[model samples]
Target: MRPLAILGDNITTDHLSPSNAILASSAAGEYLTKMGVPEEDFNSYATHRGDHLTAQRATFANPKLFNEMVKENGQIKQGSLARIEPEGKVTRMWEAIETYMNRKQPLIVIAGADYGQGSSRDWAAKGVRLAGVEAIVAEGFERIHRTNLVGMGVLPLEFKPGVNRHSLALDGTELFDVVGEIKPGADLALVVTRQNGEKLDVAVTCRLDTADEVHVYQAGGVLQRFAQDFLAQ
Candidate 1:
């Protein structure tokens, strides 16, 4: 998987998918405008989440988003920004996500502590999964959000004790491979291959805590598993 974005600590589901008032310049707001919905009628992202077309655009759309992939004046800049790989082009987060979607690229998000801490918003996980993010490696994760990710078929891996994004010195420019089988609390290896032909393996723990969780992930998510079960009967 390719590094799609690098985030700092205490990133809430609100940050992943904001529920605040939609601004005219935001992706969701613009789409509403094109569809003839008046600017004032464009509700908060939380209200429109059932509509994937609009919700997907709001993933990581928080106004306070601080993607380390974006830098300014030789320092990491804050905001909804992303640096696309191979070309190393820095662009707006939504634009980069659109580019990756066009290329069918699978993405991995690297993050610091409390990776998903906030209100238990299912759309938070759904939005990223729709954005082509296949996995997330972080120092820690909220119990609810971790389950939410598994329910959405996104693998959640935790860094070994005391290890974090900073310890790895990741610049969000590496190709990552999650090697090994899926098992609750299993020791998985995250192999990072640098752009200059260097490699390192960091141990990560699979965050699936039970057999049911594993089954849900294997079936592609909670909804998919339920659908299959319903069909089987």
Candidate 2:
């Protein structure tokens, strides 16, 4: 079980992950360096997919690192900070996920309303999936971004009306425990426990709306799902 890593309401994909065109020699660059990717061609964080170095570099390469970033040591800081582990230093977000992706760790993200509300970029989903994010639980979601998550084999969940992160007291520091199989409109319990020993249980509804979504997710992605279906027939 991984902590849900909650965020405040109205977090767009651009905020969830960095989107600008410029890539600085920050945490993302450091990961790129480890992966042998030159810092000059780092490009946007979006372009790093299929390459570990680029993705890790861009994890914190956001030119405009949101002020909402909550550091691992329980301190939220502006801009990117290097996540230091026994494996050396890596971008914070990527560092959290690198452990999981390589070891096949199960992960989840918790957020407030309007999650994934931004450009309908597939990389938004790809990034999290590559990082081993199995699911996202938020107060709400944008239509396209939700689909994008499903397309990438990541689950998107919504908090019930009148129930939100505020009431749950989630501060992006709690480890979340999600139960049940992914199904359209399925009910699941999000178990969150804070560092101070506080516990929060949030009710969530699965956002995948169609059987087609299940197919895409089960096949690991839209293209793979399509290819399988096309080849079968």
Alpha-carbon local distance difference test for all models? 0.91, 0.67
> In angstroms, how far off is 224's CA in candidate 2?
3.3
Over the full model, what C-alpha lDDT does candidate 2 score relative to the true structure?
0.67
lDDT of 2 at 33: 65
Q: After superposition, how far is residue 216 of candidate 1 from its true place, in Å?
A: 0.9
Query: Once superposed on the true structure, which residue ranges of model 1 sit more than 4 Å away at CA?
Result: none
TM-score, cand. 2: 0.76
| Best prediction by lDDT | 1
User: How well does candidate 2 match the true structure, expressed as C-alpha RMSD?
Assistant: 4.1
RMSD of each: 1.1, 4.1
lDDT of 1 by residue, 1-233 (tens): 88788999999998898999888898888888999999888878878978899998889888788898888897888777899998999987889999999999999999989988979998899999999998999989999999999999999999998898888889888999999999999999999999998999999999999989999999999999999899999
TM-score attained by model 1: 0.96
